[model samples]
Target: MKTKLLIIHSSDELYGSDRILLQVVQALRDTYRITVWLPVDHQDGKHQLYRMLQERAVEVQHMDMPILRRALLTPKGLVRMARLAPQVARKLRSSGADQVYLMTSACLLLAPLARLAGRKKTTLHIQEPWGPREAMLLRQLAKFTQQRIAISQTVARSTGFAADQLSVVHNAVPRLDPANPPKPLELDADCARGPRYLVASRWVRHKGHGTLLKAWSMAGCPGTLYVLGSAPDSANRIDVRGMVAEFVSDTASVKIIGQVANPQDWFDSVDALVLPTDTVEGCGLVALEAFRHGKAAIVSDSGGPAEVVDNGVDGWIFTAGDVPELARIFDRCTASSLAAMGEAGLRKYEEKYTPERFDENMRAEMPGALLGS
Candidate 1:
């Protein structure tokens, strides 16, 4: 019989963690029976991921213990773990899972329970670099896990996780079809007079929309900027709208369109991808998507973008929060050389980013970690 896996994901939001779980589950379905465990109630991308996994014939398991979730963060997390331990212990003992994989930092609390459940090996996929308190939690729990999977080397280093103890794995996405993606939005010669750029990310502080606005104003960028993200409230959306408001133009030159369900539709509309994140990003999944679609990326040097973008080859890199350098790089990408660089980005994605490649990696790492008994 094939080995079974209990994949614990605290939340199933459409963000990076959920997406990575979906990709890994798809990759490993052939060799292992996969059970996805989510602690939260269903949301947008959660439904989508559930559908996707069911379509692929993977089993889906949803658990509801709101108290455990609330307690999992405080002293209550340990208390809740103590209260709920028996239930998880029952599942682990009864299910006969050979390995348990914890998908995010929040779910790491379950490591000890997993170990007790007869899960011979537990692998913790650390997707973020925590501060002192959270790092302490990980430190205390580290011995319960057999392997530490880091989505990027930067994240690994930031965690103070020793090199030999962790494995750096680049997050992979399905490669885009170069030949027949939907056509880009047409721009008239006058509309095309200015450069066109795109950025797809949540409208949050660390994403560097503030820096982007500052650099755009400094550069006197005449191009239309298409910003894509969902706005939870007026205040959160204001920074983005305010940035475009400052651009003083009648040409729809800085259009802040609302949230997009299918980002590829917008991806088809622009010339390049821009990521100016000032904080740590576990992995720049958006940048990878941009590259997969054959668009060159101009990204900040702070985090995972630096790892994905190769100086001037596949994409351009700039120091975080440096307005002048961003302007220079933006101007450079508008040049004739930009198109060829985009093609290079496409080649890089095909060679390095694909579900099959991720599947190969998981198959290599997971099976051996399973209990021999």
Candidate 2:
């Protein structure tokens, strides 16, 4: 009989951390029975996470966990978690879970759950930057968790985990075949704009969409910008749309392409990937996605994206939030340079970031008996 594993994931959206968790679950579902507990389910219909996990037949559970939401920082939030911890611990003990895994930082609150169940062999995957406050919050579990998986060197150093306990597992995903890849969506090539650049991420304040817009305008409106990913559903969503519209006031130089099922399919149409992040991101999977698609990236020198991009080798890196530097990069990149850089990036992905590499990583981190028949 295979060992049963219980995973605590932070969000419902299929972002970088979520994608990595899906990859691990997909790989080990055959060797170990897997159950995933998500904080919430996608609104309206389904998010990409639900559909993808269903295809693999992995069991997903949705529960209202206060620690997973914004309320965790409030006074009432601490009271709620203090009251809820024991109940969650009971659920873990009753699940007959052979192993417990924490998939993201938000799931760190569940550290008490594994301990209360007397499961000492818990693994915590740190996907976010661990500063002093974050380290202090998770300090209690530093000695308890059996394994610590860091997505980058920056994260590994920040956590100060013992060398024996730490495993640096970079985020990875399945690559689309380059020969007969997803077809590009044909659009009007009216002499109305220059070459196109794409931004594929959740549209939030921290993503630096506004900075990209400022740089695009400052760069003399070099090319058409295609913004992909889910538009924010916040009260600011309309304001965000208005801001984007204001950026491209007269000409059709910018587009709020909204969300898409497979942004990679749309990638076949754009010039290069642009990620202008203001936060100290853990690992920008967007850079990997771009590389796998034989595309180069213009990433901010913030955190993990820099690790993915070899400065001026496969792509360019500008100081994060420096609109003028971003504008300068946009000014320099042409069709020929983008292709050469993309080919180099593609080589790096094939050499480092494939599914085989992901499987090897899991096998290395997990015990032999659990991952093997």
Choose the strongest candidate by lDDT: 2
Candidate 1 residue lDDT tens string, 1-373: 8778788787656678888998878777788778887764435544766676677777876675232233345875667556776887777688677788888767765777777776778888888766666677666776688888888888888777678777877889876666756665655452465667788888877788877877776676657777888555434444678666764344256677767666786776677788999877778887888787778888998777899999899788999988788877766556356667788988888777777777777778765543222
TM-score of 2: 0.90
Q: Residue 309: error of model 1 in Å?
A: 0.3
Give per-residue CA lDDT, model 2, range 67-97, as digits (tens): 5445466887788877878878888788888
Candidate lDDT values, in order: 0.74, 0.78
Model 1 lDDT at residue 329: 74
Candidate 1, TM-score vs. the true structure?
A: 0.89
Tell me how candidate 2 scores on lDDT: 0.78
Quote the lDDT for 229 in model 1.
84
- Give me the displacement of residue 356 in model 2, in angstroms: 1.4
Candidate 2 displacement at residue 147 in angstroms: 0.6
